[model samples]
Target: MVCRVSGILLAVASAAAVGGCGGEGGPTSPPPPGPPPPPPGPTIGASLNLRPGEVHVLSERDAIRAFEIQGAAEGREYQVIVMSASLSEGRTTPLRVRARADDVSPNVVPNARTNRSGRDAAIPPARGLAGELRPDRDWHLRQMIETERELRRLRARPAEGIGRASRGLAAAVSDVPRVGDTLTVRSAIVPGGGVQCTANTPIKSTVRTVGEHFIIVEDDRLAGRFTEEDYADLDRELDEFIAPVSHEYFGEPDDLDGNQRVIAFFTGEVNRLSEPESGSVVIGFHWIGNLFERENCPASNEAEIVWLIGPDPDAEFGIEIGVDFVKRVARSLVAHEYQHLLNASQRLGGQRGQDTWGNADLWINEGLSHVAEEVTGFYRQGLRVRGNYGYTELIAGDPDLVAFRDFFEGNLENAREYLSATTEFNPLALNNNTLDFATRGWGYVFVRWFGDRYGPAGPGGIVAGSGEAALYRELAVGGPGYLFGYENFLRAAEVVAGETTTWGDVLAEHFAASAADDAHEALPDGAQFSTWNWPRLWEELRTAGVRGLTGGDPLRRRIIQMGAGVSSTDEFDLGSSTARYYHLRAAGGHPSMIVETTIASGGNVPNSAEARIIVVRTR
Candidate 1:
């Protein structure tokens, strides 16, 4: 049954569940055969619809110190305590959350009673909403809560090795078809792909060939999109362009002989086939489920490489350019995915395994992949560096004057909107879309910097090991007994730079003073030095003693503390009709990069008329 609340149908979990939200009185209806998917869930907190720089603050008297939301079925709603209160006002920054497709009723399936068993039975107790029950609440609620708790707890724990996210992933591999054979399987990463589907009801697929180095499979529908020539061209391109790049950086293919080849799967309408935001055109993932015990995934073989393909020039994915753009995107996708395949290859002992999945910060993994794109040099033949490099640099570097004209002339909302727009354009979030490029653009810059300064493995040597261990190993800590862990990259930079100076000192000398800064610059040309038009920002950077440096920096060069020399928090204000961006390194007990935007004199700002603050942590 569906309880209508606020004109929206609400499907409650189980009656025994606690903390569930209740509907104001409404009518009930039967659940439909298949429900429309839910919007993406909140990341690390409740759905506050907060802007990037906005913060959610709670007073000290609140009971829940921390809580996480576990989004389950489309219709079912589970009650979860998002966060607890602290004595001091707690600040929470905005985070983007990805919708999950693995939220079906967990216990109903065979051996699905626990995460290892394909069920999430070990999570803390959660309550069901007070509304009509679409599906039995207990199983779905249990699955959702347990899965979330497990994932979160896993994130909190140290990184082990890359592995499957659940026992179900083992099934994903077992469902694989041998070369020259046809088989059907459920779509896990794709949209409209049922979560609870079995062999009887699966996406039709076939493995046409298992070459010495690659196994090719195609969705029945996707195969129809390409002609024989198209398939041949695609195969040749992968063999010639993509595989070679992967081998060069990540070491040789696991097996050069035909005995064990990587498995590549292609699908059509990839954007529509799965939750739109979560599904990309090309994907290569190693199942690392934190909730369940380690299980063998790519079941047919532990080393099998899984590839999910997307459209050739898919407009839905913002690729509205042209065939050249599409082909360029496709090549990058192949290279990026193949690198992931290599990163997770156990045969190479490349620091990938079940535990390493999601554990390696995006900066490291995506940065390396971006480096892979440039293995042949950005401008050289066979490499389409212009698109990736140019766009990302434009976004990373100085803000475009045209884009901010309205905001500069208008009010605070306009400024926020403009800033948000720029952030969305760049991914690796570290540098606008740097976070989105999945850590591609600026990340590539970091890898390049580290490699040039340190050596081949350079920092990669640490990344090739466990995540937490690697981080602490390089970061210095002031302790009498500690042998490992530097306080930060600063101390480590001293060793790498062979000097007493900090990374900040070196960056200023290289970027602002030298000509090479043009080629090695991570931000725009004018953003550094005195060229930046925003006087307030320039002053803040100089006063903060952080000039030209931005979050995109691997060392997090600029530090902004309240009473530190960098101007008071009050200076963050730039009067009404003003927009300013400041990058300050996290200091003292707080180890995070703080990005604060000031809106002193604008009527458009929804928050306090005085100013607003949002802190970005450099993980």
Candidate 2:
């Protein structure tokens, strides 16, 4: 029964399956499986995040996504591994990767799997990302971290390890940054106690304040700024200019070291006088342009004098006005002003006198100063007079010495006459007729005459010893005062000579002596005559001249003849006849005298002496 039932079931199941298949089609296949799903797309295997000085692992999703973009559908499989990564300040770090893949068909192998390593290696590390944190994605992260840490330590210990590194960096960049050719420094005086200077680099140093006290360094852009080398050169030149003059006038180098000494001396003198010191005197030893300018006087000393000196052309003394003459002139100027100071202090009588311009007796003051210049040798030798009063005017017209004198005396008869005079006296008038000769001519002549008459044992005997003080005393009280008061100095001199045998007699004797000496030198040895031995020869000649009416004897006639002889033969006469004869007679001695003349052979008076022989002995 079980077998019959199994057979019947099998037969029915088959019939049912056949009938169902026959209902659909003649050969029905099992329902086709739903279209095979598309092969799985590549997966993102990894991703990375980076930071400064650090490394990071990449996410698997990022890696899969990269593979997906790089791989195609055929056969995609990859194991991506980062080989290295690096980062730097101005550059991006490169990431290296390794990848491998295999598939049934080469065409089916996805390009992403085959080239995953190369594609990963090409990507740069994200900015701010460090290599250390991305070990899996970037193997080189460890190396970068080690290097960066070393750099950090080096920078931290800049004084130690950084020097070498910095030097290396500098050397590497030596071709880039270049140094400049010149550097400058700018300096200025600060109101208080010091000076401020600026240069290319910060510099703070104190300089020596001995010679040039206030000195400051200046920047290159500042005008008049100098460098060390320039300062050295300038200093050298300044030393030269000041050396000679300073040595001559101010003693030695150790005594007067700088301009301060000069200032102190002037100020001390002024203060001693108790006069109201008006203004400050600025002594600018370095300034060269103009020595003085009234308009630019400092407010502290409105009436002050500014003495400026320029660089020395010779480079001997680093001072201005080093020339000997210049220093002498300067000294004289100072002395002159000092004298005025003294007069003011003493309340001298002459100081109160006024001239035509309502000024004090400038002539006397200036004349005295002019004389002082000679005595002190402040000016060139022989510069006794102020010469050029009408020189400028003389250029246009012949100089009228008389007119010049009138102008100088300020004694013009008329305004027109005054106008016609040389302008030297009126320096303010720059007219065409103005001349400088008046100052030169009158100044010198008057001073010379004064010196000749009154100086050093002249008749009045006013010697120049302690400047004008002694001179003034002698002039005020000595023979000069009496003679000047009586208007008889010249007359007195003449009378003194006349009473002692006359100036003419003395001069004659001098000429005769000089002639005799010359003739003696030229003659044979035995021909010379001694005044004592030939007393009669000289005595006979004294009375042989034309007799005079006033004199008892013909001594006056002899004197006249002697005077004539001097005038005729002065050129050949070496010594002054008047001087020689006075000395001889004062010493109780006489000079041998002689006369010689050449007459034409045809002259009349045969057998007569051709030349008259005259001799005089007045012992």
Candidate 3:
């Protein structure tokens, strides 16, 4: 809100003579020795003019009085006068007088400073006393009240709109399948080099596209209902799934134990589902329900993939797969789910325990999984891709992100809301919350910093492996060790862009210099400062300036840093005080020698003490 103020006025009052008392016993014996010369009248000054309902304070020295102008309006001008009198007891009495619109003419007395003071002076308008004044109703105040009401109404509707939109979208897409269908086949290939299926068998599988490689499954069950469009959509999705991971390492072959365990695990499941040992997982493409619903399944030791039949896969995961070659849709689904399997295996060592599933490490798990989907060429919406990257980068960048990530991963504060029936296994929980915003933003910054500091090594010298643990370690160890270590990534970014000087250095110098002026002289010794303690001081350093200084003699200089300059002398007289001074110098500039004085009082004896030395960079 912006505020505008008009000019103010100050009015002074003149002394009035007291007439002699009439019919009062010959003037009460000559006014009791002249009544000590009939002490002087009070000097009157104008009250502070202000808008109606506006709070104002009148302060003379330390004594203050607060009042609101009840009759004035915003953008309107009025005159107010203050009359003050001092009593023999050294106390002051005050009175306020005001003039509203049309109460005084604009051309009144042609800017006369005062009316004639003699007995023959013209009589001025009968200005009412303070007791007679009344507050006027201001139209501007009414307008402001109405404006606030309208704004509140306007703000309320958008919130409702957002809630409605969320509900509508959820309702519309709630039934779409979270996982693609899985199919079991009795043979490796048909006479036409396509998948052949046998009855009463099922294999766990998911759909994915990997480059140009295509897998096709054709079964008699799907012959009448499947259309050409369905096949094409499946192929397209397959292509999208394989794009990002085609050249990227989902995990090192060594680390994944040559992928044998992963392949063996899936193959064993396929063998059970298919008759006569087909030796392969055949995917059957279909829709089940929302991603969360699939994740909510209570079955322990159940196969990770399930098959369902439906008209559209695009309705889920926001991917579009044109219809055609229904067999490839099955293959794509297998590939996509396989990637997840591979990722999960690498992260969890191929463990199939229920505890290993949905570990709530969504920032890393989902972020990396989404990245896997992207790298594999899945044609998901750009927003989803960006969102994943944004979150990944955020985690990579800051220690605070780690804290927030841990909080969300643990489902601490908003755990119930996040794990509610309506939203289970939902990555959107993090994205929609304030915690995600801070983490992601900070993570991106940290990743950029890691790139700058380590160069091509790109965080832990491993490009594709999960870098979370390494990044967390680096932040924990490196941040407090150096200035702006938390913001090191941003500093590196600035330096790369030619901003010169790391943010750490700048902050340290500023804080070191500003410490003197704003130092807490009365604070307990050995008190520690944390992030929460420095905001105002930082603002002052940024907006104002900081001064650095050194105290003590040459043998041992006591570094005294100040944001504003500190007085040199420590001595203070009952009548006057002098500031203790220290030598000043700029950061990275020459050091100059100077002298400072110290004065001690109170005549108290000191005792033996012990001290712990701690070194901290101010920036």
Could you say which candidate leads in TM-score?
Answer: 1
After superposition, the stretches of candidate 3 with alpha carbons farther than 4 Å from their true spots are 1-220, 224-247, 252-339, 350-358, 376-619
Question: Alpha-carbon error at 391 in model 3, in Å?
Answer: 20
Weakest ten-residue segment in model 3 by summed lDDT: 573-582
Off by over 4 Å in 2: 1-329, 332-363, 378-437, 454-619
Query: What is the lDDT of every predicted structure here?
Result: 0.31, 0.22, 0.25
Query: Sorted on TM-score, highest at the top, how do the candidates line up?
Result: 1, 3, 2
In terms of lDDT, the best-performing candidate is 1
lDDT of 3: 0.25
Reference-based TM-score of each model: 0.40, 0.21, 0.24
Q: Give the root-mean-square deviation of each candidate in angstroms.
A: 24.1, 57.2, 27.2
Q: Could you give candidate 2's per-residue lDDT for residues 391-479 as a string of tens digits?
A: 22311232433222212211111111211111113312212232222322223323233333233332221121212233343322222
- Report the Cα lDDT for residue 319, model 1: 24
Give the Å shift of residue 245 in candidate 1: 2.1
Winner on lDDT between 1 and 2 is: 1
